[model samples]
Target: MKRFEDKRVLVTGGTRGVGAAIADAFAAEGAAVAVNGRSQQSVDRFLATRWGDFHGIPGAVGPRDACRAVVDAAVAALGGLDVLVANAGVFDELPFEQVTQEDFDRSMTVNLGGVFFCAQAALPALEESKGSIVATASDAGLISYAGAPAYSAAKGGVVSLVRSLAIGFAEVPVRVNCVCPGNVDTDMIREAGEASDDPAAYRAAAASRAPMRRMATPEEVAAAVLYLASDAAGFTTGVALPVDGGGVAGFD
Candidate 1:
């Protein structure tokens, strides 16, 4: 049988990029997936095209009420929940001198706050199913990235939060883990490259910086999420598994 046959899953910020890849992977593995996005339009667009089997739950993950609503909706739609992938986040690149209160708040709210509240809201259903949670952190969480301090801080919180939740949910027998990816080839990274004065040079520099000599694909990161959520990782919890091409192995 396929690995996740008959399972139910919810993936936050799943309309695009790595989240979308994770959602698609679950669906392909025979799981019923509910995908959450900030807007109904984006969710509808995704479902109407490549991911029709996925139920789209449109809402922001930052607010506690929204996270609760999204999780409730997913459970109702899928009949139960087996996995929750808290992957909604934003990234910014700016000098520390230019970092504003708005920047820091937005980073923490969407990245760290989203993961916390989403998992909290999903806890009851997860306990019932003895399910698992896989959060998308970043290599920046393990090691600092010069231009994006707020992002690094938020993801670092995610890494720590996974550990706490793993222990917190031990009695419930729910596993919690996280994936820390390095540079990835996604629209987010493409936009970052376009923002640079020398787009091609910026892209090249990013690839060269990774020990693998290239950025990771979203599918590659999704595979890690799959393992963490599957029976293959039944004994694993509270791990911040790195999918970073050894980028975090040494200082850059």
Candidate 2:
């Protein structure tokens, strides 16, 4: 049988980017996947283009109620929750002094709170199913960088919370972990490069920054997520796995 054969999975912010890749990986492994996008329209668009069919659980999950609702909908749609991939997060690149209240709140609400409340709400089902949670953290969480203080802090919270949650859920044996990805060649990065005054130079800089001299693919990150969620990682929990190309290890 496939690794996740007959398992039920839910991926938040699975409409595009890394989230979409993770959802696809689970579905390919024979898991029933419920994908959550910020809205029904985005979810419809994602499903329309994707070759693999997935259950759509659309909602903007940041607030406590919103997170609960999204999880509840996923459980209702998939009949149960075996793996919850908390991939919904907002990223911003701005000067710290210019950061506004709305920006900070939005970052915390989506990146940290989304994971917290979603996991809290999914605990009962996951405990019963002996399931797991794999979140999408970032290099910002592991190490410091300029231009995105708020996002980094929120993701840092995610990293710390994953460890704590893993310890707390040890008795239930419901694993909790996260992936800290470095520079990824996603649409968001492409857009940033395109918007820059020198797109090629910007892309080149991003590539050269990583020790491996190239940005990671969303699928690569998804692969790590799959590993953590699979039985292969049965002994793993509370790990902040770095999927980055040695970015977290050293600057080099």
Judging by TM-score against the true structure, name the best candidate.
Answer: 1
What are the per-residue Cα lDDT tens digits for candidate 2 across 1-252? 889988999999999999999999999999999999999999999899877648999999889999999999999988899999999988777789999999999999999999999999999999999999999999999896688899999999999999999999988899999999988888778887887789899899988888999999999999999999999999899999998888888757
In terms of lDDT, model 2 sits at 0.92
Candidate 1 regions with alpha-carbon error over 4 angstroms: none
Regions more than 4 Å wrong, model 2 = 51-53
Error of 2 at 205 (Å): 1.7
lDDT of 1: 0.94
Which one wins on lDDT?
Answer: 1
Alpha-carbon local distance difference test for all models = 0.94, 0.92
Pairs that clash in candidate 2 = none
Tell how far residue 29 is off in model 2, in angstroms: 0.3
